[model samples]
Target: MKLNKHTVATRYAKAYYNLAEEHDCIKEAFDNMMDIRQIFGENPGLGLVLSDARLTLAQKRPIVDNLIKNFPELMQNFVLMIFDYDRMGDMELIVDEFEKLYDHKNRTILAKVTTAVPLTEAQKTRLADVFVKKLDGKKVIFDEVVDPEILGGVIIEAEHQIFDGSIRLNLETLKKQIAK
Candidate 1:
């Protein structure tokens, strides 16, 4: 039986999250993971290099060690374990799963909001307030996107739901109604 990437990542992340919680270092672990994710993002080839079959664990140890030298002992061990298990390629997925656990623990929701223009701080606050109620009071964090193609109104995607109130969509609806 072959486990998928997500399953492997979730198992590792859940175990890591539990360990961090036990050590009372969840925040620190989360911060370090975010930084590590950024590092992976900035260096797209890092994962490939670490996962290369030609490079033995001894050769990859120094690189991984140097990259995470400043992190706490828990995180250091976690990274080493992942590397030791040849799961370096799934580091990003692990980080993402860890983030989801962190957010759920903190009662936070990440909403991707798209609008025709940039929203003011006031608008953002109001939007968040509205979504907060809809989301059963989870603190809302906006990932704002500006797309002129929407023409007007807003489109919100969060928690596997999409609230598309864009003018373009409304116009299409109207056109269909007229045709009918």
Candidate 2:
């Protein structure tokens, strides 16, 4: 059987998660993963450089070392292993998978909210509170996106569900009804 990218990433993520748990450093691992994820996300070129096929481990090690200069020894080693395996391209996916595993273990959910306008801190807190309740009181981690095309209202994505209250969507619905 051929293992796909997701399977490979998940395997690595689980292994790292287990190692962290065994060392009682899950929190530290989680924080480090977030930091690494953000770095990779913000600098796609860095991911490409680390994952470049022509680069030997010796070549990659220095780059990895510089990038993770202040990282905990465990995380630095784990990241180096990914580069060693030529799986640096999958770093983002691995981080995502790790977050999913951590969130599941912690009974938390990540919510993505898109709105036509920027939300105030109070609004964000209220939205989180509502989502927390909607998610059966699980802790909610919110990621907000501003999309003026929505015209008005908000759209939420959580646990494979979409709650769209956007004016654009409502207008489309009304249009369909009028056509009928």
Candidate 3:
């Protein structure tokens, strides 16, 4: 079987995670990973700087070092490692891989629930409780979002399954049934 991208990312990310854990810098490393992801994702110029062959490590390292000066030393070292390996283009995916490692280590599920309208605090609490109960009392890192395009109701994505009960889905189903 062919090795998938996720597998490759996980392998590299796990190495970083192991190093971060050894240095007792998982949180700092994770946070810096997030920051590096955002910086690379949102700023093409920053990415170009890293990818440019004309820019030597002597030049690039100091620039990046100053930007992440306050982050943990391991994070700084990780940046250098990535730069040395020329894996800067995969920064976002690597961070996502690292986050999965962090979440798995912490026994948490980062959930995302979206509804047409914002749920009340009580509603959020109740839904979060439902997830907690359903997961055999495992922690649910519940996150909720509102999308008016859904028209109404909710679409919850937790673990790897989706629970879609949105008004938009209902209307589509009704339309399909009517067409039939």
| Better-scoring candidate (TM-score), 2 or 3 | 2
Query: Model 3 lDDT vs. the true structure?
Result: 0.80
Provide the overall lDDT of each model, using Cα atoms, as 2-decimal numbers.
0.93, 0.91, 0.80
* Count of steric clashes across candidates, in order: 0, 0, 0
lDDT of 3 by residue, 1-180 (tens): 866667767887999999988888888878888888777777776756866789787888777677668766777777777777766656667889998888888767788899988898899888878877776546777687889999998998877889898999999999999999
Candidate 2 lDDT, 40-116, residue by residue in tens: 87887887888887977788888888888999999988988897788888899999999999998887988899999
> Which portions of model 1 miss their true places by more than 4 Å?
175-180
lDDT of 1 by residue, 61-92 (tens): 89998988998888889999999899999999
Clashes of 3: 0
Reference-based lDDT, residue 119, model 2: 95
**Which ranges in model 3 have alpha carbons more than 4 Å from their true place?**
1-8, 38-44, 136-138, 142-151, 167-180
Estimated TM-score for each candidate: 0.90, 0.77, 0.74
Q: Total clashes, candidate 2?
A: 0
